[model samples]
Target: MSVSARDALRMAALYVVLSMLWLVVAGRVLDHLFDGSVAMAVGSHLSSLIWVLASAVLIFITRARLLSFIGLGTRRRKQDSERLRMAEAVFDTTLEGVLVTDRTGLIVHVNRAFMRITGYQQDEVLGQRPSKFKSGHHGPEFYRQIYTSLAQTGEWSGEIWNRRKRGEIYPQWQTIRAIRDDQGEVSHYVAVFSDISAIKHSEQELAYLAHHDPLTGLPNRLLFNDRVEQALGTAQSHKRGCALLLMDLDHFQSINDGLGHTLGDQLLKRVAERLSHWLGAGVTLARLGGDEFGVLLERCPHVGEAASLARDVIEHMKEPFSFEGHRLFISVSIGISLFPSDALTGEQLLRNADSALFKAKANGRADYALYTEELTAHAQHRVETAGELRRALEQNELRVYFQPVHDLTSGVMVGVESLVRWEHPERGLVPPGDFIPIAERTGLIGEIDLWVLRQACSQMMRWQAQGRSLAFVAVNISSRLFSQRGLYLEVAQVLAETGMNPALLEVEVTESAVMDDPEVSLEQLHRLRELGLRLAIDDFGTGYSSLLRLKRLPVQKLKIDQGFVAGLPDDDDDIAIVRVIIALARSMGMQVHAEGIEQAEQADFLLQQGCQLGQGYRFGRPMPADALKWG
Candidate 1:
């Protein structure tokens, strides 16, 4: 079959011809038949032997060349048998589960890993369809899409859930390739897959940690914001509406301050549970941050419905909870913002909800309010006010006005309460009621409070140098500023700089401030008292004015709220409350001062009630320091 074999045959024929010719010629010479001459006979035999030996040598050379050509040009049957053995070895030894299927998705071949991974023997899967391993985790459309891609691209790689022989479903990372024949028709599909259950589980855990709050086990701000964005997009496309409710727990700081943060954390977890149960499945409740949460109603029917839901949340938040041997009572203020009406984006929705929350808190907490155009205006106004307040502190736009507190028995001045008033350049005089709470929220109160304290002390010293011996001068302390670290030191430094006696410097704090964080407030109060300064509870009976907490406070004076006394004599409850407070203060060795005494009857009633001090419009409106006549 080879050219070299043909050449060898031709060479063999040529050698045979040459050998025959020689033999014929030698035979002619040896024609001298076996004559009586023994030498002639021996010569003929030697020539014939030599001719046969040469012919054998030619045949050996031609055969060797023919065999060498055959070995190079053609494969032997035994080599094919060895190749089949090696391929079987590799197919059986591979670690991955290999499945060979016809183009119709039927199983035609499977390796040992396929048997191990699916817990099935080779015989069981050999003739079965690939769908036998389908866990039904994907729908028909999913498979259609996969097959379509494989048909178009000749390959596919993805994750899928498959069933094992043990009737358990597991995830697998799979790669499938289309096997083609010489005519380019798909002959089979080879799919290589491996179990990925552990990988899937790890991925789920990581996702949970990333999107859920660790302490409360609720969706955190990250996931909540994502849901809100999705809801907004859906609402926009569907021509529907959604509502975002922002809620914050009131009096939550008191829990953390009275009980440690551990107890507070437990309480928050319980609160999250309550909200999740009550908010329903359609609403997503998420813990945004400390004491604050958010809810997204994906398809709210109307703003009124959202309002009603917010109301329910507020009402439920009032329910008392007992955790870790502590009874906790908290309330929530909810702010609602509607999609496509109030905002279009997640950020705008959150901001609008926050603005409504501010309005809810300002109007009185523990209630729900809808976002309105006015609320946005008010929010912008608050921002402007905050900026102005900051500049006011830096530019000295705040001034202190002193209101004289008198001894009702002697009809003489005892001390003056220093109040800070903001003098706005454009708006003229801005009342404390308008800007004080704003300052507190904007975090600008701390600076303004310190400035007021310094100014009050300096004025008191000036009065003392003028030969006016006063009992004391009180400066109202803003609770926002009182919570800062080194507050007592700041007060002490101010007193030291002004050369004012510590005993003559009193700090008046509202009852709510003391109740905000009783533990921290008590510690600060003790520190101030230890500095030789006096403490008083201003606007008494207006907030969490508990007799138990009052007993523990280092307070020397109880200033009755003007609200109660403003409508006294006509309001029996007011009269009875005032009598009771005066009796309680007198018994505790604390002086009582009745505020807002405008009518003679009010002053007369206070005098008879054994109240020792009074201050109101009847005596004198709050005046400038220079207008005060101490003597």
Candidate 2:
């Protein structure tokens, strides 16, 4: 019981005891002092009336105190006033919305925060249940679970979907507790919650970025690998075949180099859209870094079906993709590896597919290749060869062989194109065709290229001392080296060390290399040109060159690729291509050099086509520097 009620009870007990004592003592005194019976009765009645008046005054004071405790009357304590104000401040100032409902589950009170969050006024929500804010996203069972938890444990706190006054559904982290009376019976329910929409959205975004490519907004390698693993499991259970098609965009590096990276990123997004559109059900298409994409087909029953799918993709990509007024034509080389037959695991499947993709690119891109045991053997061989070549390069076991470049009309040796050959201690001399690609793939070509340049410069210095009549000693710079900014410095250092005239050195950069990053290549070429050296675009007809960019190149010679000269005067296509290249060279005021001349007819045909220089078996095969006896 409250202190006010106890005080009231004590006051009433004291009044009863005093009133009984007064009645006994006053009756005796009145009877003893009065002579007549009428006088004694009158005294007793008068005394009773006085005691009633005292009781009335005491009852009035106690009733007023009790009313104050129940908040019906004015408060009499300083602490009570401050405590009431403090509780009101807390309820109004808290960030989380606070709501109170009566024992009947009707909303009785809501704080200012509740009004701000739900957009409902106090008068509007009063006497209404929380169902007014139901988002309808949760079914009956969901609410039942919430009520069950609250009833058993007196509280339920979790994420829930709630509707605003505007009818928009949003998420909130809410805690609903059953507030009970002193008798342990629930008298009210209080709910406290905060908006978690922003938090939930951030979580979703983090999850998406973790497994998706930022550029393409498609599944990245991580997600792609996971889907492939899932597909393999499904295929195994059903005893069906699954195909993993690894597609690589052909010559994509050139685009990225020529165009800015921003444009490249935009193109990647566009490519993702196209891939997403073309893919059907049972397949997951993903961006697997750079210009590579992986397609996981869970139901590719046979190799033929996979090949058909690959062909369709190739054909689809053949169409030009127009972006921001640039019509770009691109092709995809797809490499397919079958499940169970080729491999059982995702890693093996991907490896086999990648090996096949290498072949597709090597055999000429815009095609498809199926994984074969032979391809795997070739890959193993390449790995072994790359290791040996690295060793050969480091151990000084590699030799520079010079091939003669002649004046086509005069049939005179004017220059020699320097080539690298690996003289393995055990394997004898390994031709460039066998190890060049390997070196390029392993990133050892740049080092080999620099070494060859230094060697060639040194050999030419010897020839200069011996009074050789050669106009220049040309060094074929690998694509890997040509793109580097340090090429000019390396060449200058070699020239300075060897004391060879810069005019006697011709650096031959391939047409493809020059076009890769034309702006950078232009600056590179100009730097070399400023050093008084000749620059030539080697294998001209093979690489697609922009005429506008080519005209800006500081080149004196254009070497027609051997592939265009193998058939020479016989093959119409070769003849036509050679004639056009020679004309193109002439038009650009560049010297035309024909390579791979074996017979007199090939040399004669090149000479007839007005080609200025020719290098091939016709003049002399590639030989060591010692073989050229100029002295």
Candidate 3:
């Protein structure tokens, strides 16, 4: 019961006692003073009634005031209870862990989330300091900084590594705030935090993926370039030499085509692993793309060190790799460029290394080449020439020249091979060797091949109109064009437009081209054969051709590469190779043609060896159709 109710009851009891005494005394006095008087008795009765009415009114007013005070007190208690429930709900249900501490930093209270996140019970950490959950990842200075900030600003928030109850370390985002009393004095501290381990892990994964190759788990081009820039800076500062090596796997495309991409990817991973194993400290190896890898050698002592490393890389790569029971042999060509010697900037270093790699590939596979100033000049020239070649095609500055092939037995011009010559207005005449490679590299070879095919066909028809009876007109096709999907359609269209017989048109592809992807090459060759055009393998002996695969090819002829022919009968190896090729062609019932016959002895030797066809400078150099001399 309320104090007000108790006081009201006491006052009422006092009034009741007084009223009883007064009633008794007044009744006696009235009886004694007005004895035997009827009027006096009546006056006494009226005075007693008036006193009773006043006492009843005073009691009613006090009771009403006490009831109003009691009701107001009850409503205030109900409101306080509701507010307590709301505070409890918020404290327990919030996702963020809440911990309250006294001014001395001892934990006083913790919410359900705090218990769940730290794996600690409320009883276990009730009076413990926040240091009890320290992961030791942050030093004393780190905590001092936080405390200093908190002291100055009354609050602090940041990422912190904390230890859970199970002794595992995790990251959390935490905010600590100081609670002050009404007098502006600090009395308590509250901390709210959330586990951010998962977010940190995701960020790390994203960062790693950005800089690494997904297939090989090797650093990618972006990372490689950044590392190169750093390495260059270090080299420049320390006055030390550094080397950049760019590597390309030789015949990797053939392996990819033959064995399938999955196996190819596995091969690349193995290759990366081997290269990484061979690298010493301070060396970084990365995959630039598709069978291409980059190596940065920091603090290299000299060029000889770079060369030695390159040689070691080549030798290691030469070792055969066995994957899924298939023994595969791989080789890499390396191009080395030095910092502050060959080039300075990261971009130039990479470019020069790539240029050297191209030279290494051209010299022959399985070798290494150092970047030279000459290579840069050549590369720049090729870039300029590629642009000119593109314009040449658009402006009709290209001309078709014919080189006649003679039947060795009859000594008669049988067929003519069509070759393109660029009549550069300023350079006079640019050889095909000068610009054809550039065209191929720039992806302009297909367009050039198409143009050559159409012009060659048109020229053959013009020669026929002039009463020249040529056996056939052969045109060289780029490897890219041979694999193109629309090659058949393009050839068909050219033939229809030129009104030439497909039987008299022969398309020549290198042995490397057909063997690159024999299945696809077979399919494409079959499509071409279906058009009634003859197909031949050019530079036959220069590539690795399996006789079994060669037998399966849809070709009618194999032209001996000029290299083997140049060293004729006196060169025993050349003689043996040529004899074997001719014998192989005869056994397969395919025609054999010998190229690069510069002397009468070479021709006589070829004829004696049973080679039926020959073409070289001896018969005639490539010339315009109007300048051709028929013999």
Best by lDDT: 3
40-94 per-residue lDDT for model 1 (tens digits): 7797789978877877886688678768867865666568878999988888898
lDDT of 2 by residue, 79-156 (tens): 678899999999999999999999889999999999998899999999999999999899999999998998899999
Clashing pairs in 1: none
What lDDT score goes with residue 570 in model 2? 92
Candidates sorted by lDDT, descending order? 3, 2, 1
Off by over 4 Å in 2: 1-93, 100-109, 124-170, 174-191, 384-399, 404-414, 423-428, 441-451, 454-471, 480-502, 514-524, 543-552, 564-588, 597-614, 617-628
Candidate 3 lDDT over 233-293, as tens digits, reads: 9889999989999999997877766667899999999999888887856689999999999
Task: Rate residue 398 of model 3 by lDDT.
Answer: 94
Return the TM-score for each candidate structure: 0.68, 0.72, 0.75
Q: In model 2, how large is the Cα lDDT of residue 613?
A: 89
After superposition, the stretches of candidate 1 with alpha carbons farther than 4 Å from their true spots are: 1-210, 482-486, 516-521, 569-571
Which structure among the candidates has the greatest TM-score? 3
TM-score of 3: 0.75
Worst 10 residues of 3 by lDDT: 251-260
